[model samples]
Target: MSRIMVIGSLNMDIVSRVENYPLPGETIKGIKTDVNPGGKGANQAVAIARAGGNVSMVGAIGTDVFGDQLLEALQQENIETNNIIRKEGTSGLAVITVDSKGSNSIILLEGANGLLSMDDLTDILPEAIKDPANIFLLQNEVPWETTKNIIESLSASNASIYLNPAPAQHIPTEIISKLTGIFLNEIEATIITGLSVIDQESASAAAEKLIAYGVTEVIITLGEKGSLYRDFREHVYFTPGRKVNAMDTTAAGDTFIGAYLASKQQGYSIEASLEYATAAAALTVSREGAQKSIPYQEEILQFLT
Candidate 1:
């Protein structure tokens, strides 16, 4: 089986559910609020494990209670966490607000996640990344420079790598060329490519730009509408999102990514994997919380069947 290693952030997600988003200088009462163990990296690790992918977590956490809780949560998922180090200060934090429509906005505090460095990566991967089956699942929650260095370091290796650039930032085209694939939502798509992704055609145009930069594959997720896929070969595909009662969309993107990668690792075809991921994400939105809302592999299978 292919092993996926997630090098991303771990945060305590604080979420508030409001009727709608508050405008600038406006305040609104929340329907409810809760805290959950989440970080793009940690969330994806839980997702991969739950989706039946062989996964390991590599990152840093604080020495606080949240860190202890985060560690315990990963352990419960049966993910390998040997590379998750402990820093001196507070853990990462994500303050989020979800509307009744299941849409959300978030603000993040870097904290220990910012402590991740190339040295940490060197200690974790070493020579294993030379193996193509050792897939690295990364995100933008960590330092961009560190992330870039990891990609550059693997340029000489055959390792498979993918980036989910949430909270998108500028990256060099040379670095983009080294990736096996890039998965992102429409909003993130706009930030990275400087193009609008209001629909499938727009998303494709954006994907084409990345393909021209030499990334092998690009998948742009369209919330509720569906997802669009395009590769360097100009081959394109679309997968419609499943209609359901969406309660919270906090983990939808992460769940989709986790399930899709797990499905691919398990030898599912691209079409099947997209379906699996869409189903997994649809199931996640029907529930509440981040990692807690994500379904297990059997649940996705059952949901599909």
Candidate 2:
């Protein structure tokens, strides 16, 4: 099995289900509320482990009750967390609001996630990264400089680097170009490239810009519309979104990435991997919460069949 290392944020997600997202300054009554252990990194790690991959995580948590619960949840999922740094503050949190259409709006608080520094992450996983069988999956939840340092110094093994540039922020162009793989949403692509990404034409255009900056492969996720793929081999593929009765859309993209990585590690072809991941994400949207909704591999296979 492929060993995956996810280096990013861990948070407690506070979710509220509302009839519709309130307009600017408008008040709307929510149907229910729930708290779940979530964070893009944690969600992805769980997805991989549940899909039958070996996974380890590197992140920071606070010395709060939320942090304690989140760590336990990860351990229950069989994700290795020996590298998680516990700091003196509260853990990160995402205030998520889901509407009846399964659409979501999130307000994230950095909290302890923002405290991870270059020194804190450097030696924590050196032995793990030395194994050529591992893959490093990174996110933008931590400091950009810290991520850059780790990626730049990751020459100890042949492990490939996969970057998910979510919550897009200004990053150094040189650093982005070194990524072996990149995942981004349509909006994030536009923000990074200063292009309008309302259609495939724009997505393709923006992707070209990103490719010019150095990524070897790119996956642009278009919610409800499907996804587009580009690689150094000059082939482009698209998968139209599968129809489903979506209830809460939290962690859908993280689920997609996790499933995709697991499929690739299983030696499935790119087309098959994308199809499987799309199916997994479709199931994720039909449920609620983040890590709580990720279907097992068999469940996703059944959905696809």
Winning model by lDDT: 1
Q: Write the per-residue lDDT of candidate 2 for residues 1-305, one digit (tens) a residue.
A: 66889999999999898998888999878899999999989999999887767888999999999999999999998999999999898999999888887677889998889999978865765777666778899998988877888788663354589988877876567877778888889878888888888777777777788788877888989998998888877678888889999876778999999999988988889999999999999999999678999999889888887
Residue runs of model 2 more than 4 Å from their true location after superposition = 17-31, 97-105, 155-158
Candidate 1 local lDDT, residue 295: 94
Score residue 89 of candidate 2 by CA lDDT.
Answer: 89
For 1-305, candidate 1 gives per-residue lDDT tens digits of: 66898999999998888998989999889999998899989988898899999998999999989999999999999998888999999999999888887677889999999998998877567755755788888999989988888888776675788999887777678888999999989888998899988888899899999999989999999999999988877789999889999887877999999999999999999889999999999999999788999999999999999
Error of 2 at 55 (Å): 0.9
- Give stretches of model 1 more than 4 Å off: 16-33, 97-105
Candidate 2: pairs in clash: none
Candidate 2 lDDT (Cα, whole model)?
0.86
RMSD of 1: 2.5
| lDDT assessment of candidate 1 | 0.89
Per-model lDDT: 0.89, 0.86
